[model samples]
Target: MSLSDCRILELPRISDPRGNLTFIESDNHIPFGIDRVYYLYDVPGGAERGGHAHKQLHQLIIAASGSFSVMLDDGTERRTFFLNRSNYGLYICPMIWRELHDFSSGSVCMVLASRKYEEEDYYRDYAEFQEAAEKRG
Candidate 1:
């Protein structure tokens, strides 16, 4: 996939004076079926997460609380998205490199994955990921 395949998906939100509620449904709101769910929180300031690409995973990354930036790189192009809203998710297709940084205090990043975590599906090396991405194109 290419960087153009990545985009922000706005979740359904219900606003109220008491509180706000938002929700996501697998295959109903997202483009893929959800197989795993996780989140990142309590990150030390300036600490970065995600410096790899998935070989065959579709992911929807949401800023559950606070704010942060997500950098996505394909073999050919790069884009950065600032995520601060709980109701907006960045949908990342397969074969794209991702890095999360510039986290505000108390930021919580939630992720919905299309597959269970598998060690072999990850491309931790940028050069290797680039080479594979080139081949995929």
Candidate 2:
């Protein structure tokens, strides 16, 4: 598709003095749907997570506690995003290689996914991911 097709995902925010809250709903906040929730935490500075690509999963990632960045690549194009606020999220589409890096200390990244954990869904090898993405075109 186009770059616009893989842009950031807009999420709903609720503010209160007690605290703020954000929600991600299946087929609602997300387009495809949702089935999984995972969080990454305690990553040191200059460290990274997620160096793979998914076959058919969509995700909405948020900085629930602190801040982090997501670097997305689609073989031909790339984008870097900073998620610092709890009320915001980054929606990542499938077939895109993503690297979640640059985590500030105490950062908690919550990911809402559209697919369950399937071993076949992951492309752990970069060379394999590139070949598969090219084949899809």
Q: Model 1: runs farther than 4 Å from truth?
A: none
Task: Report backbone clashes per prediction.
Answer: 0, 0
TM-score of every prediction relative to native: 0.98, 0.91
Candidate 1 per-residue lDDT over residues 37-81, each given as its tens digit: 999999999999999999999999999999999999998889999
Estimate every model's Cα lDDT from 0 to 1: 0.97, 0.83
Q: Taking the tens digit of each residue's C-alpha lDDT, what string does model 2 give over 1-137? A: 42346766667878799976777668877786777889998898898899998888888888888888888888677889999988778878888899998899899999888888999999999999888888886
On TM-score, the candidate that comes out on top is 1
Give the range of the ten consecutive residues with the poorest summed lDDT in model 2.
1-10
Task: Identify the leading candidate in terms of lDDT.
Answer: 1
